[model samples]
Target: MALLDIKGIDVSYGKSLTVKNCSIALDPAKICSVVGESGSGKTTVIRAVLGLLPGGGSVTAGDIVYENRSLLKLSKGEWRSLRGRDISMIFQDSGAMMNQTRLIGKSFVEYIRTHESISKQDAWKKGAEMLGRMRLPDPDRIMNSYPFQLSGGMRQRVGIAMGMTYQPRLLLADEPTSALDVTTQAQIVRQMMELRDEYGTSIIIVTHDIGVAAYMADHVVVMKDGRIEDQGERGYILNDSTNAYTRKLIKAVPSLGGKRYV
Candidate 1:
Protein backbone atom coordinates (compact mmCIF):
# COMPACT_ATOMS: atom_id res chain seq x y z
CA MET A 1 0.00 0.00 0.00
CA ALA A 2 1.17 3.53 -0.60
CA LEU A 3 2.31 5.26 2.56
CA LEU A 4 0.79 8.61 1.54
CA ASP A 5 -2.05 9.27 -0.86
CA ILE A 6 -3.05 12.79 -1.78
CA LYS A 7 -6.25 12.35 -3.75
CA GLY A 8 -7.87 15.20 -5.62
CA ILE A 9 -7.41 17.76 -2.86
CA ASP A 10 -8.42 21.37 -3.21
CA VAL A 11 -6.97 23.67 -0.61
CA SER A 12 -7.98 27.25 -0.02
CA TYR A 13 -7.44 30.31 2.15
CA GLY A 14 -10.80 31.85 2.82
CA LYS A 15 -12.30 32.48 -0.65
CA SER A 16 -9.06 32.11 -2.60
CA LEU A 17 -8.21 28.68 -4.00
CA THR A 18 -4.66 27.42 -3.79
CA VAL A 19 -4.12 23.76 -4.70
CA LYS A 20 -6.68 22.12 -6.95
CA ASN A 21 -7.37 18.45 -7.61
CA CYS A 22 -3.83 17.37 -6.77
CA SER A 23 -3.03 13.69 -6.44
CA ILE A 24 0.21 11.84 -5.71
CA ALA A 25 1.04 8.58 -4.02
CA LEU A 26 4.29 7.96 -2.20
CA ASP A 27 5.57 4.60 -1.04
CA PRO A 28 7.96 3.86 1.78
CA ALA A 29 11.68 4.49 1.34
CA LYS A 30 11.18 6.43 -1.88
CA ILE A 31 11.70 10.08 -2.82
CA CYS A 32 9.07 12.26 -4.49
CA SER A 33 9.94 15.77 -5.58
CA VAL A 34 7.27 18.41 -6.23
CA VAL A 35 8.71 21.17 -8.38
CA GLY A 36 7.19 24.58 -9.00
CA GLU A 37 8.00 28.24 -8.66
CA SER A 38 6.95 30.07 -5.50
CA GLY A 39 3.16 30.50 -5.15
CA SER A 40 2.49 27.41 -7.26
CA GLY A 41 1.27 25.72 -4.04
CA LYS A 42 4.15 23.32 -3.45
CA THR A 43 4.73 24.46 0.15
CA THR A 44 1.02 24.72 0.79
CA VAL A 45 0.52 21.10 -0.27
CA ILE A 46 3.07 19.77 2.19
CA ARG A 47 1.81 22.10 4.88
CA ALA A 48 -1.62 20.58 4.46
CA VAL A 49 -0.13 17.13 4.79
CA LEU A 50 1.59 18.17 7.99
CA GLY A 51 -1.56 19.88 9.33
CA LEU A 52 0.33 23.14 9.56
CA LEU A 53 -1.72 25.36 7.33
CA PRO A 54 -1.88 29.02 8.28
CA GLY A 55 -5.00 30.65 9.63
CA GLY A 56 -7.89 30.80 7.13
CA GLY A 57 -6.37 28.07 4.99
CA SER A 58 -8.23 24.76 4.88
CA VAL A 59 -8.70 21.73 2.73
CA THR A 60 -11.98 22.57 1.09
CA ALA A 61 -12.40 19.36 -0.88
CA GLY A 62 -10.88 15.91 -1.51
CA ASP A 63 -9.00 13.52 0.73
CA ILE A 64 -5.49 13.15 2.08
CA VAL A 65 -4.79 9.61 3.17
CA TYR A 66 -1.74 8.72 5.21
CA GLU A 67 -1.18 5.05 5.94
CA ASN A 68 -4.81 4.39 4.97
CA ARG A 69 -6.28 6.97 7.36
CA SER A 70 -7.84 10.18 6.11
CA LEU A 71 -5.59 12.99 7.27
CA LEU A 72 -8.05 15.72 6.45
CA LYS A 73 -10.52 14.16 8.84
CA LEU A 74 -8.09 13.72 11.68
CA SER A 75 -8.85 15.52 14.94
CA LYS A 76 -6.50 18.04 16.48
CA GLY A 77 -5.34 15.51 19.07
CA GLU A 78 -4.83 12.92 16.40
CA TRP A 79 -2.70 15.32 14.41
CA ARG A 80 -0.58 16.05 17.47
CA SER A 81 0.00 12.34 17.97
CA LEU A 82 1.21 11.83 14.38
CA ARG A 83 3.28 15.00 14.04
CA GLY A 84 6.96 14.84 15.13
CA ARG A 85 6.66 11.10 15.84
CA ASP A 86 5.30 9.46 12.69
CA ILE A 87 5.93 12.46 10.43
CA SER A 88 8.17 15.52 10.43
CA MET A 89 8.62 18.65 8.32
CA ILE A 90 11.83 20.53 7.60
CA PHE A 91 11.10 24.07 6.56
CA GLN A 92 12.96 26.50 4.33
CA ASP A 93 15.35 28.68 6.32
CA SER A 94 14.84 26.48 9.34
CA GLY A 95 17.55 28.32 11.18
CA ALA A 96 15.58 31.54 11.07
CA MET A 97 12.64 29.73 12.58
CA MET A 98 14.57 28.80 15.69
CA ASN A 99 14.36 30.52 19.06
CA GLN A 100 17.17 33.04 18.98
CA THR A 101 17.45 33.61 22.71
CA ARG A 102 17.68 29.97 23.71
CA LEU A 103 20.82 27.91 23.54
CA ILE A 104 20.73 25.24 20.86
CA GLY A 105 21.04 22.48 23.43
CA LYS A 106 18.23 23.95 25.48
CA SER A 107 15.74 24.08 22.62
CA PHE A 108 16.95 20.81 21.13
CA VAL A 109 16.58 19.05 24.42
CA GLU A 110 13.15 20.56 24.92
CA TYR A 111 12.10 19.35 21.47
CA ILE A 112 13.27 15.85 22.27
CA ARG A 113 11.66 15.88 25.68
CA THR A 114 8.36 16.99 24.18
CA HIS A 115 8.37 14.15 21.66
CA GLU A 116 9.75 11.30 23.74
CA SER A 117 9.39 10.25 27.35
CA ILE A 118 13.01 10.58 28.36
CA SER A 119 15.17 12.37 30.90
CA LYS A 120 16.67 15.68 29.82
CA GLN A 121 20.16 14.14 29.98
CA ASP A 122 19.13 11.31 27.66
CA ALA A 123 17.45 13.71 25.25
CA TRP A 124 20.51 15.91 25.17
CA LYS A 125 22.67 12.90 24.47
CA LYS A 126 20.41 11.93 21.59
CA GLY A 127 20.41 15.48 20.22
CA ALA A 128 24.20 15.60 20.42
CA GLU A 129 24.48 12.29 18.62
CA MET A 130 22.16 13.48 15.87
CA LEU A 131 24.21 16.65 15.45
CA GLY A 132 27.36 14.59 15.15
CA ARG A 133 25.73 12.44 12.51
CA MET A 134 24.97 15.57 10.49
CA ARG A 135 28.75 16.19 10.42
CA LEU A 136 28.64 19.45 12.35
CA PRO A 137 32.02 20.46 13.73
CA ASP A 138 32.29 20.43 17.53
CA PRO A 139 28.73 19.42 18.10
CA ASP A 140 29.28 19.99 21.77
CA ARG A 141 30.14 23.62 21.17
CA ILE A 142 27.45 24.12 18.63
CA MET A 143 24.87 22.79 21.03
CA ASN A 144 26.01 25.22 23.67
CA SER A 145 25.81 28.22 21.35
CA TYR A 146 22.72 30.20 20.37
CA PRO A 147 21.22 29.81 16.90
CA PHE A 148 22.74 33.15 15.86
CA GLN A 149 26.22 31.87 16.61
CA LEU A 150 26.22 29.28 13.83
CA SER A 151 26.75 29.90 10.15
CA GLY A 152 23.82 29.51 7.79
CA GLY A 153 25.11 26.10 6.69
CA MET A 154 25.68 24.96 10.26
CA ARG A 155 22.25 26.11 11.33
CA GLN A 156 20.68 24.38 8.36
CA ARG A 157 22.47 21.17 9.27
CA VAL A 158 21.23 21.54 12.82
CA GLY A 159 17.71 21.93 11.46
CA ILE A 160 18.19 18.71 9.52
CA ALA A 161 19.52 16.94 12.59
CA MET A 162 16.46 17.97 14.55
CA GLY A 163 14.09 16.94 11.80
CA MET A 164 15.68 13.50 11.65
CA THR A 165 16.00 13.16 15.41
CA TYR A 166 13.17 10.65 15.56
CA GLN A 167 13.79 9.03 12.17
CA PRO A 168 10.13 9.54 11.27
CA ARG A 169 8.42 7.23 8.80
CA LEU A 170 7.74 10.16 6.44
CA LEU A 171 9.57 13.46 6.00
CA LEU A 172 8.15 16.59 4.34
CA ALA A 173 11.04 18.82 3.35
CA ASP A 174 10.27 22.19 1.71
CA GLU A 175 13.29 23.60 -0.09
CA PRO A 176 15.70 22.23 2.48
CA THR A 177 18.80 23.13 0.48
CA SER A 178 17.82 26.30 -1.35
CA ALA A 179 19.61 28.60 1.08
CA LEU A 180 22.98 26.90 1.05
CA ASP A 181 25.98 27.04 -1.25
CA VAL A 182 26.13 24.43 -3.99
CA THR A 183 28.61 22.23 -2.08
CA THR A 184 26.57 22.38 1.08
CA GLN A 185 23.38 21.77 -0.87
CA ALA A 186 24.94 18.65 -2.38
CA GLN A 187 25.95 17.42 1.07
CA ILE A 188 22.47 18.01 2.49
CA VAL A 189 20.90 16.20 -0.45
CA ARG A 190 23.24 13.23 0.02
CA GLN A 191 22.42 13.13 3.72
CA MET A 192 18.69 13.15 3.03
CA MET A 193 19.12 10.17 0.65
CA GLU A 194 21.21 8.42 3.27
CA LEU A 195 18.51 9.10 5.83
CA ARG A 196 15.97 7.35 3.61
CA ASP A 197 18.33 4.37 3.28
CA GLU A 198 18.95 4.26 7.02
CA TYR A 199 15.36 4.60 8.19
CA GLY A 200 13.07 3.60 5.32
CA THR A 201 11.59 7.09 5.41
CA SER A 202 9.42 8.28 2.57
CA ILE A 203 10.22 11.84 1.50
CA ILE A 204 8.29 14.63 -0.23
CA ILE A 205 10.55 17.47 -1.25
CA VAL A 206 9.11 20.76 -2.56
CA THR A 207 11.65 22.62 -4.64
CA HIS A 208 12.11 24.94 -7.61
CA ASP A 209 15.52 23.54 -8.44
CA ILE A 210 15.02 21.06 -11.25
CA GLY A 211 18.61 19.91 -10.91
CA VAL A 212 18.08 18.90 -7.31
CA ALA A 213 14.82 17.21 -8.20
CA ALA A 214 16.48 15.27 -11.01
CA TYR A 215 19.28 14.11 -8.74
CA MET A 216 17.16 13.16 -5.70
CA ALA A 217 13.69 12.08 -6.75
CA ASP A 218 12.45 8.65 -7.81
CA HIS A 219 9.26 10.35 -8.97
CA VAL A 220 8.70 13.93 -10.10
CA VAL A 221 5.62 16.14 -10.23
CA VAL A 222 5.57 19.52 -11.90
CA MET A 223 3.12 22.13 -10.73
CA LYS A 224 1.94 25.36 -12.30
CA ASP A 225 -0.63 27.74 -10.82
CA GLY A 226 -1.54 25.35 -8.01
CA ARG A 227 -2.25 22.35 -10.24
CA ILE A 228 -0.16 19.38 -11.23
CA GLU A 229 0.83 19.85 -14.85
CA ASP A 230 2.92 16.70 -15.21
CA GLN A 231 4.08 13.79 -13.11
CA GLY A 232 5.92 10.56 -13.87
CA GLU A 233 8.93 8.48 -13.09
CA ARG A 234 12.24 10.38 -12.98
CA GLY A 235 13.56 9.12 -16.31
CA TYR A 236 10.34 9.71 -18.26
CA ILE A 237 9.77 13.19 -16.86
CA LEU A 238 13.39 14.14 -17.55
CA ASN A 239 13.84 12.74 -21.05
CA ASP A 240 10.51 11.98 -22.77
CA SER A 241 8.15 14.75 -21.74
CA THR A 242 5.73 15.92 -24.47
CA ASN A 243 4.20 18.69 -22.38
CA ALA A 244 5.52 22.15 -23.21
CA TYR A 245 5.59 23.27 -19.58
CA THR A 246 7.42 20.12 -18.54
CA ARG A 247 9.90 20.65 -21.37
CA LYS A 248 10.47 24.21 -20.22
CA LEU A 249 11.14 22.99 -16.67
CA ILE A 250 13.60 20.35 -17.86
CA LYS A 251 15.50 22.90 -19.92
CA ALA A 252 15.72 25.21 -16.89
CA VAL A 253 18.22 23.12 -14.98
CA PRO A 254 21.66 24.75 -15.20
CA SER A 255 24.34 22.60 -16.79
CA LEU A 256 27.75 22.04 -15.27
CA GLY A 257 30.48 24.08 -16.91
CA GLY A 258 31.95 22.00 -19.73
CA LYS A 259 33.07 22.46 -23.32
CA ARG A 260 30.29 21.75 -25.80
CA TYR A 261 30.71 20.53 -29.37
CA VAL A 262 28.17 20.56 -32.17
Candidate 2:
Protein backbone atom coordinates (compact mmCIF):
# COMPACT_ATOMS: atom_id res chain seq x y z
CA MET A 1 0.00 0.00 0.00
CA ALA A 2 1.04 3.55 -0.64
CA LEU A 3 2.31 5.63 2.28
CA LEU A 4 -0.05 8.45 1.38
CA ASP A 5 -3.30 8.46 -0.59
CA ILE A 6 -5.13 11.74 -1.18
CA LYS A 7 -8.23 10.87 -3.16
CA GLY A 8 -10.89 12.98 -4.87
CA ILE A 9 -10.47 15.87 -2.49
CA ASP A 10 -12.32 19.20 -2.70
CA VAL A 11 -11.24 22.09 -0.49
CA SER A 12 -12.89 25.45 0.00
CA TYR A 13 -12.36 28.87 1.50
CA GLY A 14 -15.77 30.21 2.45
CA LYS A 15 -18.10 28.99 -0.29
CA SER A 16 -15.52 29.08 -3.09
CA LEU A 17 -13.92 25.77 -3.96
CA THR A 18 -10.23 25.11 -4.45
CA VAL A 19 -8.39 21.83 -5.07
CA LYS A 20 -11.16 20.04 -6.91
CA ASN A 21 -11.11 16.32 -7.48
CA CYS A 22 -7.49 16.11 -6.50
CA SER A 23 -5.84 12.77 -5.98
CA ILE A 24 -2.21 11.74 -5.50
CA ALA A 25 -0.28 8.99 -3.80
CA LEU A 26 3.27 8.52 -2.57
CA ASP A 27 5.11 5.34 -1.80
CA PRO A 28 7.75 4.84 0.83
CA ALA A 29 11.19 6.31 0.09
CA LYS A 30 9.97 8.68 -2.64
CA ILE A 31 9.46 12.39 -3.18
CA CYS A 32 6.41 13.81 -4.96
CA SER A 33 6.36 17.39 -6.13
CA VAL A 34 3.26 19.54 -6.55
CA VAL A 35 4.09 22.39 -8.90
CA GLY A 36 2.03 25.43 -9.83
CA GLU A 37 1.97 29.19 -10.00
CA SER A 38 0.88 31.36 -7.08
CA GLY A 39 -2.80 30.90 -6.09
CA SER A 40 -2.94 27.52 -7.76
CA GLY A 41 -4.09 25.91 -4.49
CA LYS A 42 -0.79 24.13 -3.83
CA THR A 43 -0.66 25.56 -0.31
CA THR A 44 -4.25 24.50 0.22
CA VAL A 45 -3.34 20.88 -0.44
CA ILE A 46 -0.42 21.02 1.99
CA ARG A 47 -2.56 22.70 4.64
CA ALA A 48 -5.25 20.06 4.20
CA VAL A 49 -2.71 17.27 4.57
CA LEU A 50 -1.51 18.84 7.81
CA GLY A 51 -5.08 19.48 9.03
CA LEU A 52 -4.32 23.14 9.65
CA LEU A 53 -6.55 25.05 7.27
CA PRO A 54 -8.37 27.84 9.09
CA GLY A 55 -10.98 30.55 8.35
CA GLY A 56 -13.73 28.15 7.30
CA GLY A 57 -11.50 26.29 4.92
CA SER A 58 -13.07 22.90 4.89
CA VAL A 59 -12.62 19.66 3.01
CA THR A 60 -15.94 19.57 1.20
CA ALA A 61 -15.25 16.12 -0.21
CA GLY A 62 -12.67 13.29 -0.26
CA ASP A 63 -10.26 11.80 2.22
CA ILE A 64 -6.52 11.68 2.98
CA VAL A 65 -5.24 8.29 3.94
CA TYR A 66 -1.75 7.98 5.43
CA GLU A 67 -0.39 4.58 6.30
CA ASN A 68 -3.83 3.04 5.58
CA ARG A 69 -5.83 5.29 7.93
CA SER A 70 -7.98 8.27 6.95
CA LEU A 71 -6.56 11.51 8.30
CA LEU A 72 -9.64 13.57 7.52
CA LYS A 73 -11.62 11.42 9.92
CA LEU A 74 -9.10 11.56 12.77
CA SER A 75 -10.10 13.35 15.96
CA LYS A 76 -8.13 16.32 17.29
CA GLY A 77 -6.51 14.19 19.97
CA GLU A 78 -5.60 11.58 17.40
CA TRP A 79 -3.99 14.22 15.25
CA ARG A 80 -1.99 15.50 18.18
CA SER A 81 -0.67 11.99 18.77
CA LEU A 82 0.06 11.32 15.10
CA ARG A 83 1.27 14.63 13.67
CA GLY A 84 4.83 15.12 14.91
CA ARG A 85 5.58 11.44 15.18
CA ASP A 86 3.97 10.15 11.98
CA ILE A 87 3.94 13.31 9.86
CA SER A 88 5.86 16.57 9.91
CA MET A 89 6.06 19.71 7.79
CA ILE A 90 8.82 22.14 6.89
CA PHE A 91 7.52 25.51 5.83
CA GLN A 92 8.95 28.16 3.48
CA ASP A 93 10.26 30.46 6.16
CA SER A 94 11.84 28.41 8.92
CA GLY A 95 12.79 31.27 11.19
CA ALA A 96 9.32 32.67 11.11
CA MET A 97 7.98 29.35 12.37
CA MET A 98 10.22 29.52 15.45
CA ASN A 99 9.77 31.43 18.65
CA GLN A 100 12.10 34.42 18.85
CA THR A 101 12.08 34.58 22.60
CA ARG A 102 13.35 31.04 23.17
CA LEU A 103 16.63 29.40 22.30
CA ILE A 104 16.39 26.69 19.66
CA GLY A 105 17.91 24.03 21.92
CA LYS A 106 15.32 24.65 24.62
CA SER A 107 12.37 24.50 22.23
CA PHE A 108 13.74 21.48 20.38
CA VAL A 109 14.28 19.59 23.61
CA GLU A 110 10.76 20.39 24.69
CA TYR A 111 9.35 19.20 21.34
CA ILE A 112 11.13 15.88 21.69
CA ARG A 113 9.74 15.32 25.17
CA THR A 114 6.21 16.12 24.00
CA HIS A 115 6.23 13.14 21.65
CA GLU A 116 8.39 10.71 23.63
CA SER A 117 8.76 10.28 27.35
CA ILE A 118 12.48 10.93 27.25
CA SER A 119 14.64 12.65 29.80
CA LYS A 120 15.44 16.33 29.13
CA GLN A 121 19.15 15.61 28.77
CA ASP A 122 18.47 12.83 26.27
CA ALA A 123 16.22 15.07 24.20
CA TRP A 124 18.90 17.76 24.14
CA LYS A 125 21.45 15.22 22.93
CA LYS A 126 19.08 14.02 20.22
CA GLY A 127 18.40 17.58 19.09
CA ALA A 128 22.13 18.22 18.86
CA GLU A 129 22.62 15.00 16.93
CA MET A 130 19.99 16.00 14.35
CA LEU A 131 21.63 19.38 13.86
CA GLY A 132 24.94 17.66 13.21
CA ARG A 133 23.28 15.35 10.69
CA MET A 134 22.15 18.41 8.75
CA ARG A 135 25.85 19.35 8.54
CA LEU A 136 25.73 22.23 10.92
CA PRO A 137 29.05 23.03 12.58
CA ASP A 138 29.07 23.46 16.35
CA PRO A 139 25.60 22.10 17.03
CA ASP A 140 25.91 23.21 20.63
CA ARG A 141 26.29 26.88 19.65
CA ILE A 142 23.39 26.67 17.25
CA MET A 143 21.21 25.10 19.93
CA ASN A 144 22.14 27.85 22.34
CA SER A 145 21.47 30.68 19.87
CA TYR A 146 18.14 32.41 19.30
CA PRO A 147 16.38 32.03 15.96
CA PHE A 148 17.35 35.55 14.89
CA GLN A 149 21.01 34.85 15.60
CA LEU A 150 21.26 32.34 12.76
CA SER A 151 21.40 32.96 9.00
CA GLY A 152 18.46 32.09 6.77
CA GLY A 153 20.17 28.92 5.60
CA MET A 154 21.05 27.88 9.13
CA ARG A 155 17.52 28.55 10.34
CA GLN A 156 16.05 26.46 7.54
CA ARG A 157 18.44 23.63 8.40
CA VAL A 158 17.29 23.78 11.99
CA GLY A 159 13.68 23.48 10.91
CA ILE A 160 14.50 20.48 8.74
CA ALA A 161 16.45 18.80 11.52
CA MET A 162 13.62 19.33 13.99
CA GLY A 163 10.96 18.06 11.60
CA MET A 164 12.93 14.98 10.61
CA THR A 165 14.17 14.22 14.11
CA TYR A 166 11.27 11.90 14.83
CA GLN A 167 11.73 10.28 11.40
CA PRO A 168 8.09 10.71 10.40
CA ARG A 169 6.78 8.49 7.67
CA LEU A 170 5.43 11.46 5.72
CA LEU A 171 7.05 14.84 5.20
CA LEU A 172 5.13 17.81 3.82
CA ALA A 173 7.33 20.61 2.55
CA ASP A 174 5.57 23.80 1.49
CA GLU A 175 7.91 25.91 -0.69
CA PRO A 176 10.73 24.97 1.66
CA THR A 177 13.56 26.46 -0.38
CA SER A 178 11.75 29.44 -1.91
CA ALA A 179 13.15 31.80 0.69
CA LEU A 180 16.81 30.69 0.44
CA ASP A 181 19.63 31.74 -1.83
CA VAL A 182 20.53 29.62 -4.83
CA THR A 183 23.50 27.97 -3.14
CA THR A 184 21.59 27.33 0.09
CA GLN A 185 18.66 25.96 -1.89
CA ALA A 186 20.88 23.43 -3.57
CA GLN A 187 22.43 22.38 -0.27
CA ILE A 188 19.08 21.94 1.44
CA VAL A 189 17.68 19.97 -1.47
CA ARG A 190 20.65 17.65 -1.34
CA GLN A 191 20.13 17.16 2.37
CA MET A 192 16.46 16.37 1.87
CA MET A 193 17.34 13.77 -0.75
CA GLU A 194 19.82 12.28 1.65
CA LEU A 195 17.13 12.20 4.32
CA ARG A 196 14.97 10.07 2.05
CA ASP A 197 17.92 7.82 1.20
CA GLU A 198 18.80 7.26 4.82
CA TYR A 199 15.36 7.01 6.40
CA GLY A 200 13.02 6.13 3.50
CA THR A 201 10.64 9.00 4.32
CA SER A 202 7.79 9.79 1.95
CA ILE A 203 7.75 13.47 0.99
CA ILE A 204 5.33 15.85 -0.71
CA ILE A 205 6.72 19.17 -1.84
CA VAL A 206 4.78 22.20 -3.18
CA THR A 207 6.95 24.31 -5.46
CA HIS A 208 6.79 26.77 -8.36
CA ASP A 209 10.34 26.06 -9.55
CA ILE A 210 10.25 23.25 -12.07
CA GLY A 211 14.02 22.83 -11.84
CA VAL A 212 13.82 21.97 -8.17
CA ALA A 213 10.88 19.68 -8.83
CA ALA A 214 12.66 17.88 -11.63
CA TYR A 215 15.75 17.49 -9.51
CA MET A 216 13.91 16.20 -6.45
CA ALA A 217 10.68 14.50 -7.51
CA ASP A 218 10.00 11.00 -8.68
CA HIS A 219 6.40 11.99 -9.50
CA VAL A 220 5.11 15.45 -10.39
CA VAL A 221 1.62 16.93 -10.20
CA VAL A 222 1.00 20.27 -11.88
CA MET A 223 -1.76 22.57 -10.68
CA LYS A 224 -3.47 25.64 -12.06
CA ASP A 225 -6.31 27.73 -10.67
CA GLY A 226 -6.93 25.28 -7.80
CA ARG A 227 -6.99 22.15 -9.97
CA ILE A 228 -4.52 19.67 -11.37
CA GLU A 229 -3.42 20.65 -14.85
CA ASP A 230 -1.32 17.53 -15.38
CA GLN A 231 0.55 14.78 -13.55
CA GLY A 232 2.89 11.91 -14.31
CA GLU A 233 6.31 10.50 -13.65
CA ARG A 234 9.17 13.01 -13.77
CA GLY A 235 10.29 11.85 -17.21
CA TYR A 236 6.77 11.97 -18.63
CA ILE A 237 6.03 15.46 -17.31
CA LEU A 238 9.29 16.73 -18.79
CA ASN A 239 9.35 14.83 -22.09
CA ASP A 240 5.79 13.93 -23.15
CA SER A 241 3.46 16.55 -21.75
CA THR A 242 0.16 16.94 -23.59
CA ASN A 243 -0.98 20.00 -21.67
CA ALA A 244 0.11 23.53 -22.58
CA TYR A 245 0.29 24.51 -18.90
CA THR A 246 2.75 21.75 -18.16
CA ARG A 247 4.84 22.62 -21.20
CA LYS A 248 4.97 26.25 -20.13
CA LEU A 249 6.14 25.33 -16.65
CA ILE A 250 8.80 23.06 -18.11
CA LYS A 251 10.16 25.84 -20.30
CA ALA A 252 10.32 28.38 -17.47
CA VAL A 253 12.89 26.59 -15.33
CA PRO A 254 16.62 27.13 -15.85
CA SER A 255 18.92 24.25 -16.68
CA LEU A 256 20.21 22.31 -13.65
CA GLY A 257 23.63 20.62 -13.70
CA GLY A 258 23.62 19.27 -17.30
CA LYS A 259 19.86 18.64 -17.42
CA ARG A 260 17.74 21.06 -19.47
CA TYR A 261 13.97 21.61 -19.15
CA VAL A 262 13.52 21.35 -22.93
Q: How many pairs collide in each candidate, listed in order?
A: 0, 0
Worst 10 residues of 1 by lDDT: 253-262
The positional error of residue 194 in candidate 1, measured at the CA in angstroms, is 0.5
For model 1, how does the per-residue alpha-carbon lDDT over 185-220 read when each residue is reduced to its tens digit?
988899899999888989999999999998999999
> Mind giving the per-residue lDDT tens digits that candidate 2 earns over 209-244?
888988999999999998988999999999998899
Which runs in model 1 stand beyond 4 Å of their true positions? Answer: 257-262
- Reference-based TM-score, model 2: 0.96
| Candidate 2 clashing pairs, residues 3+ apart or interchain | none
